[model samples]
Target: MTRNVGGIDRAARIVAGAALILLALTGAIGAWGWIGVLLLATGLLSVCPAYLPFGFSTCKAK
Candidate 1:
């Protein structure tokens, strides 16, 4: 898959994802917080399936 996620977006996703997971683990959030895995995965992969249909992308043209 082509990368649709860019520098800041990727970083935000990773941070948010990690925060959610930590909150879940600490019982500060519901199990649904596990959904953060999706964010983490997308960030790491640099490909966001959600962006496909609308042709959205955060990457700079290269």
Candidate 2:
């Protein structure tokens, strides 16, 4: 993975993912919160499969 996620985007993903997972554990958002795992994984890994189709990159030019 070439780090398609960066800067604020990465931070947001981590935060959102953590929150969703927490909520799910607390029985607040139901099974849908499980999707947060995807966000967390993508954020930590700095890659997103969905972005592949659009050839998108949030990472800064190196």
Q: Per-prediction TM-score, please?
A: 0.95, 0.94
**Can you tell me which runs of candidate 1 are displaced by over 4 Å?**
none
lDDT (CA) for every model shown?
0.93, 0.92
Q: Write the per-residue lDDT of candidate 1 for residues 1-62, one digit (tens) a residue.
A: 88999999999999999988988898999898898899999989999999999999999999
TM-score of 1: 0.95
Cα lDDT tens digits for candidate 2, 13-54:
999999999999999999999999999999899999999889
Structure candidate 1, residue pairs in collision: none
TM-score of 2: 0.94
Best by TM-score: 1
